[model samples]
Target chain A: MTIKENIFENLRLELRRGCLTLAVLAQLRQEHYGYTLRKALAERGLEIDESTLYPLLRRLEAQGLLSSEWREEDKRNKRFYRLSGDGEGIFVQLLKEWRAINASIDNIL
Target chain B: MDLLDRYLQAVKKHLPWQRQDDIIAELKANLEAQLEDKEAALGHPLTAAEAEDWLKQLGHPIQVAARYQPQRSMIGPALFPFYLYVLKVAFLWATVIWTIVAVVQIAAQTPSELTVLAAVLRVPGMLMTTAAWVTLIFAIIEFVAARCPGKFPMLAPPAAHWTPGDLPPLGQQLSGGRKPRSFAHALTEVIFGFLFLVWWLLVPRHPYLLIGPGVLYWHASPFQLAPFSVLFYWWVVGVNVVQLAWRSADLIRGSWPRPRTAQTIVVSAIGLIPLGLLLSVPDHAYVLLRNPALDQARYSAALTSINLSIQWSAVILCAISVLELLWGIGRLSLDRYRKHAAAMR
Candidate 1:
């Protein structure tokens, strides 16, 4: 892409950044592994690549916003991630804030 | 194992050491799980194209990871104090180094015949050295500050902005203050005035020299010194008188106002005239072209004296510039503080 196009793309990406967390939380309502979460998000029209989704899950886990455990099935181990207690609280707060902001924007529009 | 591994490796390339292993493990687990889900959904083992397509949809690894962590601000809450501290240390170190190099260079050079070239060369070393020292000191402070974060509360997070309406009136701050003009202000003017007068008088005479042959000597022309010589002397007297007046005035008034900017500018201008003459006139050109009548030592001495005078003048100019710049900074800081205080009120 041209420099200007790249810059605009970056700005668009930044604007969409906040929604990514919501999308991650919404998809991980059930225990989902990193790859499964990415596919689910893509299917839901929030199309996150694996590279983006994996680290995010890790960070969310680190911040006590996600819980995860290694499970072995069919002789292969998979790390499954689910919402932590704190994650649930944060997700609810985020969802409320998002709704309020959306409504405010709707009013302004 | 193929394109997926390569893609994963490429993503890992961008991450720092501490998080790299964890990130890699997380990604591997996630990607493996994704591949399994895809296989289950399709009810068959996935083809390479299918896997590539899935990975492609995931976007670049770094971009994906970056979304999870917001970029740290360049002048962020965590780093600004450190940055300013580094800046100040660098400035201080640079100042010290420059002063040392300047003093040494001036001491070593052949003296008496003041040339513009000698003056110009002396400046950069002093400037660079001073800048380096200042930066070094600030950097050290910042380093210490990083360890003991609370020590510098003034430089902490949530940077404040100064606005015009927020400033306290300048007159109010200066009025009814007890301390007279600072010794620094008085000392600076006196020292500068003294140096200027001394350079002017001694430089022309080639004073403190072993008179030698093939040396060029310069005397200040009557026209250059005409009015200013008298005014320069009077200004020195005036500065002392003003210093005394301000001191006595402080006995009645609580505070004294800062030295007026106009006075500084005028004094600086007066100082520059001799400097301009020194630079514009080629004092040593004639020495190289014409043999002088004096003895070898006497002529060499004359040349040395002129060279030393020029070096000293250059140093003085540099010192003056530094002082003015510092004064400007002080003025700015005071203005900002007043504005901040007013805003709080």
Candidate 2:
């Protein structure tokens, strides 16, 4: 890629990075395993790569923002994740902040 | 399929070992789900090649594994610039000490103007050893920093403690207080070098310059400068010329040059020729006075003491010279290397 294109790609990734965490937490309010969650986000036009999604799940769980469990489904094991008590509170606050930012950006644009 | 297992195993290699199995299990379940979904869409089982292509979308093993790991760095980006700066500075000192060691060895063993090049030849080896050692040390620090984030606080920039108000005025630094040695230090070196060059060239004809304060007290009979061999004159001149050139360059460049590891090695080796010459001169060689103070016995004892003082003074000077040169090398190295390191950052 040209340098300008590379720079834009990097800047675009940085722009998306903070939003991805919020999107992941919002999706996990309803229970879903990794593949299903990725599909749900993709369906909403906000696809996250497996590499990014799985790690985000692990980090969120580690931080007590999400809870996860392993269980058998269709004779195969799946690890399902959903928002924890703390995650639910934080998600609500973050959602409010996100909307404020969106409104600010919309006004500026 | 074997391909699926292999991809998981590749990822497993990079995962934190304590939690590796759990992460692998979770990862395996996710990948299996992906494969199942793909198969359902195609209405068929995937071939090995298709399965491999499916795994490729996950990312490389290193990249995938790194996500699970904390952002691993030997030295984090914050400390890496500093760590590399320290190493580059260390390389300068290493090259310098090696240079001195080479010169001293040659001056002591061969004492010829010709052997200066041999001493010069040994500099790269010194720099290489130093560079290796400095790198190894930073690597160890990096290992510690990556494994335990809180340890090695020096690895962090001052921003950890800094308020925006702590910043200097607009004229102040982005990274403050890492500048080259002042022009005064270089100027002093140049002045001293010029003085010494004059002293060596003319101390033969005018003996008063040799006797610091006693010139008025003693009879003004001139003693010969015959004891100083011709090779000795050339060696001293060469040493002074180097100092003059180096200090002059520092003055001009406003810092030491990018360590031409090879050139620096040679220059440092040549430096020893003079230092060795100063040390090896016998205590009785500097008898700059011919006529005695009317008291012969007292005068002979006093002359002996004078020669002895010169020898002792030279010894002290040599020790001090070695230390100061090492320090000079350090400062010069730091100035040059910091610029280089900052550029990399």
Candidate 3:
């Protein structure tokens, strides 16, 4: 690839990183297991791989932003996740900040 | 099902030990769900080749497992800068001291080519040992800092508690092109200076410590310090003791304030006295203890060569000390002038 293409790819990944976190947190408000949550995000135009999505779920749960429990679904044990009370409050604050940033960027553009 | 199990096992092999079972179970469920969805769309189960391709797309097992594990290093980001600083300072001092010792060895005894080669060959091993020990120390600090953060409060980041008021004043900030002494630099100096002080004190009894290990083959000891060198030894020890104390205090305080900078300049200036005395020692008259293994003529020649070497070493040391003193004074003066100008403004 050309240097410009490589540079653009890096910058794009950088831009997507925060958005990916926000998307994951926003989607985890309702209970969903890793595979379903990944499909839901992909359907909404954020096509995250299992490698990225599953680790992200684990990390969010570790941070206490999401809670999880394993339950039998379709005769197989699946870890279901949803946002916690603290996560809800933090999500609201983050959304507010994100929106403010979006407006500033829109105006600049 | 077999392929999926194998894939999970591959990932499990690379995962953190305590979390391996938990992570693999979760991963297996996700992979199976994805496979079922794909099979449903295709109206048939995936073949082994198809399963292999799918797993390959997800990533290498190690790479996938790595994403699940928290990123880690022997020395974490918080301590890495200090680790690098310690290494740089150590290697710098080692190089300087090694060069001085090599020069002294060549001039003093004029050892055989094989002896010189043997000493030179030891350099890499010595450097590697130094680096390994420094890394091990930093790794231990990193481990303790991670395991018990509250007990190691110095390593704890003040991200949440800090305010804009905690920042240095506009012109006083390090970013404003005014370089100052660093805490790591001061700490390194104190540690290395103390080590040198101990080695210097031991050198009288263990003269071979200054000379290379090749001297062990000699039937009797072949060198002695000139009488003046014996007197100048105390001066060296006194100067080093003062330096070690000052640098230790600087390390503890974590900043080089004006008064401490002034103290360093004074200490450095005083250090020049010993170097001057070292330079004035008589050349040929400075004799070494006669080695029974060598003839009288060889002994006399070696003594003359050794004394001349000592004088030259003194000259080099004196030059370095003079430059260091001048630099310290100039830096102190510049800092004072800047502070005065800032006050006037």
**Best-performing candidate as measured by DockQ:** 3
| TM-score of model 3 (CA atoms) | 0.61
lDDT (C-alpha) at residue B146 in model 3: 82
lDDT of 1 by residue, B1-345 (tens): 678788878877877767776667767766776676678989998788887778778787777556555444434455556566655545444433443343334434532345323644666776676656655654555566565878776644433434678856655344224344664665454445434433433333454332333224323311122233344444443443343333333322323345344444444555555444444444422122123443444456655565567556756785785577567556656766877888899
Q: For residues A18-101, write the lDDT of model 2, one tens digit per residue.
A: 999999999898999999999999999998999999988999999999999898998988899999999999999999999999
Position B16, candidate 1: lDDT: 74
Give, for candidate 1 chain A, the lowest lDDT window spanning 10 residues: A47-56
Assess each prediction's global lDDT (C-alpha) against the native.
Answer: 0.60, 0.72, 0.77
- By DockQ, the candidates rank as 3, 2, 1
Please identify model 1 stretches exceeding 4 Å from their true place: B2-25, B33-78, B81-108, B111-155, B158-345
> What tens-digit string does per-residue lDDT give for candidate 2 at B59-140?
8997998999766555567666776777766754454445445544643563433455455566677777777777677777
DockQ of each: 0.58, 0.73, 0.78
> Model 3, B53-154: lDDT tens per residue?
998999998999999987778988777877888887676566546645653464345344454566668779778888998899889888887889789776
Superior candidate under lDDT, 1 versus 3: 3
TM-score of chain A of each: 0.91, 0.97, 0.95
TM-score for chain A, prediction 1 = 0.91
lDDT ranking, best first = 3, 2, 1
